[model samples]
Target: MDKQRDFVLRTIEERGVKFVRLWFTDVVGTLKSVAIAPAEVEGAFSEGIGFDGSAIEGLTRTYESDLLAHPDPTTFQILPWRGEIDPTARMFCDLTTPDGQPAVADPRNVLKRTLAKAADAGFTFYTHPEIEFYLLKSDKPGPHGLEPVDRAGYFDNVPGGTAHDFRRRSVRMLEDLGISVEYSHHEGGPGQNEIDLRYADGLTMADNIMTFRTVVKEVAIEEGVHATFMPKPLHGEPGSGMHTHMSLFEGDTNAFYEEGAQYQLSKTGRRFIAGLLRHANEIALVTNQFVNSYKRLWGGDEAPSYITWGHNNRSALVRVPLYKPGKSQSARIEHRGIDSAANPYLAYALMLAAGLKGIEEEYELPAEAEDNVWALSESERRALGYRRLPSSLFDAIRYMEESELVAETLGEQVFSYVLSNKRREYEQYRSQVTPFELKHSLDII
Candidate 1:
């Protein structure tokens, strides 16, 4: 730790970094930052910076608001978007109390606690997310309504076009910040795009997800366009989903792999899939936490709505990607239901906890649903023992309220706060009259 701190300080001086930003997230996944002068970086690493935590959502109560932001030196990176003049650097932080204990309400701490359990079981969780989002002409809907920067479809390469150039610039900036983006291309929806981040450990991946969002937005602004991760931003178009590929590792070996087993998936891998399938509904609120998120789920444009697992079945919640011969390390599963808008820390924690529980309990892996789940009738799906995910934020909250796994993983403070916050969001959404209602019901009713 001392060596890392020294390295960070030396780099700040050597790179002429004028400011170091301490970054953390609220329970709901909103990024919060505080800038400190380069001279204070050393002090921050040693003693941490203090702040009033009550101001941050789901952080603390008003009376017990004092908290500390301890920057993790390993996460240090210079802000490439800031350019050469008055350069800025940033690090992700973990919140702790005055006595130096991890804050129970901190989202990062929730993930850390979960990862520790996996480590105890001789495993490390790794994830790679295919994040999909849209670039709009403007932040707000214009006179002609919300307009995409381009009308290109999936994998469409409009050379020298807005989206192509935008992705080129974005990927370069991301690489400069040390984020390994494996692939980037236009997605199914017009003006929609997807970036596939290379796999990393759970904690690093969550931090990278947060940084990825910020970079996407910053690049969008620099190019005079707006980027949105809203799961279902447009009607009659495919929604943005963060289909996350996950695997477990035991030291250098991929714990999820087996040489000759079906799909080359090990027993540990099957149990992990069982855990995810069994608890996916309960964790849906955290993974897809907005009213808009349900729209993407039920809308059914490759966004999973049913809790089932199968090899190469995109409609199933847990999908085992087809294995490559002699490449056992690449064997993994993809959880298809999580939206890009989720709080990665909390979401990833719950996922790890649920998967670990399955392994601990030796949960039985069910029959694989190879057929298209979306095409099945409700009765047919029910006959096959397939269950639907929460249809709305209201339904998701109800499942979350009943989830022992979620409650234990998030701790009491965050569990209570998330429930309360989501309930309020549901209420606020229900009170509003939508354009659909007015368009259809005003004259008819």
Candidate 2:
């Protein structure tokens, strides 16, 4: 830890970094940053920097607002988007109380707590998210109403197209920040693109996801295009889903792999999938928190709505990708329900916790749904014993409220805050009279 801290301080001075931002997240997963002068970086590492926790969303009560942000020197990276002259560096921080205990309300701490459970189980959880988003001509909806930058669909590489170049630049920026990009391609929707981050351990991956969004938005701004992670930004188009690939590692060996087994999935892997499927509805509020996220699930465009697992079935909530003949380490399950808009810290934590619970409990894997779940009728799906994910934010919240798993994974403070926050959001949405209502009701009623 000392060596890492010294390296960060030395790097900042050598690189002439004028600002070192201590980065953390609120309870809802929004990135919060406090910039410190380069001279303060050393002190920040040892003493920690103070911030008003009450001001941040779902962080603390007004009376008990004092919080400390201790920067994790291992997360130090130069902000490549900033000016090169002085340069700016950033580090993801661990939030704590004045007395130095981890803050219960902090999103990062929530994840860390969940991760500790996995560590106790002799496993390291890793995730690779295929993050999808849309590029728009402007930030606000214009006359055409949130126009996509290009009409090209799904891997269509037009010569000198904005998306092609945009992706290239975005990949470069992410690489500069030490995030590895495995793949980048245009997605099924107009102007929608997908970038798959190379897999990393859960904590590092959460931090990377946050940085990925910022880098994407920054690159979009530089290109005079708008970037959105809104799950269902455009109607009649594919929604942006963060289809996450995950696996458990017991040291260097992939714990999910079993040679000669069905789909080569180990018993541990099967239980993990069972845990995910069983508790998916409970975790929906965290993974797909927004009202619009439901649209993607029910949209029938590869985003999963059904609670079932299968091998390479996109419509199933969890799909085990086909394993290479000799490459057992690459065997991992892909969770297709999570939206790109989710707080990765909370989402990933819940996911890991749920999976760990399955392992601990020795959950039996359910029957695999080989048929496309979306193509089946509701009755057919129900008859096959498959359940649907929450249809709306309200439904998700209700599931979350009833979940012992969720309540345990997110401590009392965050669990209550998220439930209350979502309830308010749903209530506000329910009270609103939509444009669809006005357009139809004005003529009829």
Candidate 3:
């Protein structure tokens, strides 16, 4: 702690950092910040900076509104978009209460607690996210729909295109902030882009994801366009997903890999996948929290509507990527249902917990999907023992409500806040008479 604190302080002094932004997130994953002068940073390291918790969504009630944000010095990074002149910096914060207890509602702490459990069980969780989003001319939607900055299809390298330049700039900025990018390219949907971050530990990866979103949006606004992580922004096009690759490690070795196992996946790996499949429906409220998230899940461009697992089966909710020769260290399971806009801290925590539960209980791995699961008849799918994920936000809530794992992972405060927030959102959504209703039933009725 002293070493990281010293390093952050020295860097700030040497780089002439004027403002140090302490960053955190709300229950719904909205990024929040409070900037402090560099002089007060050292003091904040021990005492933390206080704020009104009641004003922020899901933090605390009016009577107990005082909260503190203790900056994680290891997360210190100079804001690339802020420029070098009198430069500003930022660090992720872990929230606490007035009495110095870890805030149960703090999303970062939720992941941290789950990670501590993994460490105690002799494992480390790592994740790689292939994040997808769209570049739009503006946030507004016309009668036809929102406009994409470009119409290029997947992997089409149009030199001098806005999306190409946007991606290039984003990758550079991310690198500047010490993030490693594995790949970047155009995706299937018009103006949609995908960037995959190199795998890192669960906590670091969640922090990186928060940083990644801010960088992308900052770059987009500076370039005179809007960027959205909306899972289903377009009706007949591919939806954006944060399809995550996850693995468990024990010290220097990959726990998921075995030399002669099927698909080279160890029994531990199989059990983990089983856990994910069993809990996938319940965790949908965290992984795909929004109502629109279901649109992406069921909209059929390989969005995964059923709970099953297979080697290289895109339709299956959990997929084991084909083993590459001499790449056993890279062996991992890909979860396809998580939307890009999810709260990474909470999402990763629940995912790790589910998989760990499977290991603890020795869950039986199910039959692999031999063909496109989506193409199977409904009864055929049912007979094959395939179960569908929740089709709506309310349905997801129902599943989540019954999960003891989710409640335990999120703690009482956070679990209650999330349920309340989603309930309010659904109520407001249900009361609205939409364009579809007006067009279909208004004059006819």
Candidate 4:
């Protein structure tokens, strides 16, 4: 008997769970679900639940539309929002073929596969994300677009404000679901909030991120406010970002730490940073996927525009925080370019791949930018050998299209589908007439 499977069954019976929701993500990181009666939970663990994949984004070809969702019992958690009456539990599912093989195009599987490669290399990856997002008054748009729940600025405290209440309720819900949050506070932008999740193994952190987005939105609905992970939701306002801190370990020893090195970063860590800088452009599609994502990257403020590493420099694409005394295990690098709206599974996979590539090839670490990269003039930055990340989604696509590393990491199924999907999206966006065009050129042209 499978202990975890049996534990899920016992919990369901003991907790009066009448519905079991099987959850997974599409290629673009949108959450998808199907609820089954309590009786079907056991069968779902063994035989798997069948679903049609014809319409799901980047899932598979429609000609062979059948797919199976095999629920991993380890992810089982009861829904807190769905009260005591017929309580619902959820488990994340892995997409599989009818023959019981892992589906190539499944974003979760893509992450799992990349993680396995790291395991083979005798390293374990860990990640912590400081997620930023905005809270709106409602989903409805006005002349000024969606209004914020509050106008609070960075770390501002507003007594009994909706943003405050929203964070409280959202944090409580996250805790109830077994996610540990390190901190929650007001961000720089109006009505923007940030919640930093404690570090966890890469796979677990990805799962936690998917759950976090859901809990925030659910609480927003209950509070009569709207929550968005959109990268650039408001014009002229700071955009939301999911800045991730990453590290690798060999058993219990942090591979990134050294006793007496510059920044206390070990040789392994330096190579890993080299890998990230070299491939940042190639993997930009997965990290900051949307066209609007570029607006945030180049929109100034805390958002990093150039590719460089530095100590405590938020203006650089990768920042190494000050090492805490007696906290050797905490030494890590923070990648700041990822927007809040990215698909966690694919994003994490490519990030791990990039870092590992650097280590494998013994890529030498570049010179650290001692001064602010964003403050430097164009010629000065070029003179220092710093490169800018993909300026737009178009440039990102061009870089990704020619990348062997990304193709191997994501597998052919996902690589082809993503390219196709993003191309269509870019074309569709270009075909539209934006308000900026009308305001600037409609009358003049």
- Report the lDDT tens digits of candidate 4 across residue range 165-193: 89999999999999999999999999999
lDDT of 3 at 158: 81
Instruction: Please provide, for model 1 over 1-445, each residue's C-alpha lDDT reduced to its tens digit, 9 standing for 90 to 100.
Output: 9999889999998999999999999999999999999989888888899999999999999988999999999999999999999999999999999999999999999999999999999999999999999999997998878999999998998877789888989899889989999999999998999999999999999999999999999999999999999999998899999999999999999999999899999999999999998999889999999999999999968988889999998888999999989887898999999999999999999999999999999999999998999899999999999988999999999999999999999999999999999999999999999988999999998
Q: Estimate each model's TM-score.
A: 0.99, 0.99, 0.99, 0.99
lDDT string for model 2 (112-194, tens) is: 88888889889998999999999999978888688999998888987898999899999999999999999999999989999
CA lDDT of each candidate?
Answer: 0.94, 0.93, 0.95, 0.93
**After TM-score superposition, what is the CA distance of residue 353 in candidate 3 from its true location, in Å?**
0.4
Instruction: State the TM-score for model 3.
Output: 0.99
Clash pairs detected, candidate 3: none
As for candidate 4, its clashing pairs are none
* Model 2 error, position 260 (Å): 0.8
Tens digit of per-residue lDDT, candidate 3, span 1-445: 9999999999999999999999999989999999999999999999999999899999887888999999999999999899977799999999999899998889999999999999999999999999999999999986778999989888989888999889999999999999999999999999999999999999999999999999999999999999999999988999999999999999989999999999999999999999999999989999999999999999999999999899999998999998898988999999999999999999999999999999999999999997999899999998999999999999999999888999999999889889999988889999999989999999999
Q: Where is model 4 more than 4 Å wrong at Cα? A: none
Error of 2 at 290 (Å): 0.6
